[model samples]
Target: MAVNEIRLSRLLRTSKMDDSENTTSFDDRSEAYSEVSARDCLAEGIIGLLLPTVEQIDERVKSTRISQLELRQHIDTLAEDLRALSEKQQIPYDLDSYVKKLVNAKRRVVLVNSILQNTQERLNRINQSITRENERRTALLEPQVSTPSEGQ
Candidate 1:
C-alpha cells in the first residue's frame, strides 16, 4: 500500500508538471498572437492613411494635366491671333508689348507644365512604393492567416 501511494504521488506530480508546461506554452502563444494582432492593426492603419492620400495625389495630378492642356490651347489661340494681327493689320504702337506678353505667357505655361510633369512622376513613384508595401504586408500576413485555418 505504501508503494502504491508513492507511485500515485509520482503520477500526480508528473501530471501537474505537464499541466504547468501546457499553461506556459499557451501563455507564450497567446502573447505572440497578441503581438501579431497589434502589428496587423498598425499595418491596416497605415494603409488607411496612405490610400486616401495617394488617391488625392492622383486627382491633383489629373487636374494639373487638364490645366496643362488648357494652357496649351491658350498658347495656340494666342499664337493664331498674333499671326492674324501681323498678317492683316498695320503694326500698332502696342504690338511689341502685346507680343512680349504672349511670349511671357507661353514661357509661364511651359514652366508650369514641366513642374506638373515632374510632380506627376514623383507621385507615380510614391504610389508604386505604397503598392509594393501593401503587397509586402499581405505577404507577411497570409501565412499567419492560413496556419490556423489549415489546422482546423
Candidate 2:
C-alpha cells in the first residue's frame, strides 16, 4: 500500500473517480475530470500529495523521469484512494493536502497537470466565496438598517 502510494504521488497524473486503475492514459481522466465537481477534484489532489515517497521530491520532479510502470503504479494508487474516499464518504478535508499534491502535480505536467487548472480554479472559487462572504457580512453589519417603528 505504501509503495503504491509513493508511486502514485510521484507520477502526479490526472485521477479518475471511476474504474480506471488499469488505464495508462490521462485522456480519460481529463475528459471526465473537468465535469467533476470542484470538491471531488480537490479531495483527489490532496490524497495524491499525502501519499509518501523514498526519493526526494526535488529529484523526482526534475532530475529523473518516471517509467511507464511507475506512472501506472501511481495512477493505481490514486484510483484506490478515490475509491476509498467514495467508500468512506469523506468530503473535502482541507487545502493543505490539495496544495501539497498540486505542487507535485505541477511538477508532473508531463506527469499530471491536466486536472491542475481545474483544481486551481476550484481553489480560486473557494477563495472568492470567502471574499464574497466577508463582503456580504460587512455590508450587513454596517449599522445602516433603519427601524420602521422609529417614526411611529
Candidate 3:
C-alpha cells in the first residue's frame, strides 16, 4: 500500500482501540465514534497534502496568464511596427512615380523646343532667298533702261 493508505489504516486502528478502552460496552455507539474520528483524521490529512499542490497549481496558472498577456502585447506592438514599415516602403515607389512624370514632362518640353528651332531656321533661309531674288531683278531692269537711252 501507499504511505497515505498505511497512515490512514494506522489512524483508524488507533481510534478504534482508544474508543474500546474508554467505553465499557462495545456497542454501536462506540463503533460509530471510532469510524467518525477515523474519517475526520483521513479527511484532514488529505486536505493537508492537497492544499500545497492546489496553491502551486494556482500560482502556475497565474504566471502563465501573465506570460500570455505579455506575448499578446508584444504581438500588438510588432503588428503596429509592421504597418508603419509597410507605409514607409511605399514612399520610394511614390517618389519613383513622381520622378518619372517629371522626366516625361521634361522630355516633351525639349521635343517642342527642338521643333520650334527647326521651324525658325527654315523661315530665315526662305527670307534670305527672297531678298536675293528681289535685288537681282532690280539690277537687270536698271541696265536695260540705260542701254535703251544710250542707243537713242
* Predicted structure with the largest lDDT when compared to the true one: 1
Candidate 3 or 1, higher lDDT? 1
User: Model 1, 88: alpha-carbon shift in Å?
Assistant: 2.2
> Model 1 reaches what TM-score against the true structure?
0.70
Per-residue C-alpha lDDT of model 2 across residues 29-60, encoded as one tens digit per residue: 55553453244346445544533331234234
Q: Which scores better on TM-score, 2 or 3?
A: 3
The residue ranges of model 2 lying beyond 4 angstroms of the native Cα positions read 1-111, 144-152
Q: 32-136, model 1: which lDDT tens digit per residue?
A: 756865775687688789888877987887798798788878877987787678777865544667777777887887788788788878888888887888788
Question: Candidate 2 — worst ten consecutive residues by lDDT sum?
Answer: 143-152
Instruction: Answer with 1 or 2, whichever has the higher TM-score.
Output: 1
**What are the runs in model 1 whose C-alpha is more than 4 Å off?**
1-28, 148-152
RMSD of each: 13.0, 30.7, 58.1
- Over 29-72, each residue of candidate 3 has an lDDT whose tens digit, in order, gives 45654675477457557656755665565455556545555655
Clashing pairs in 1: none
Pairs of residues at least 3 apart in sequence or in different chains that clash in candidate 3: none
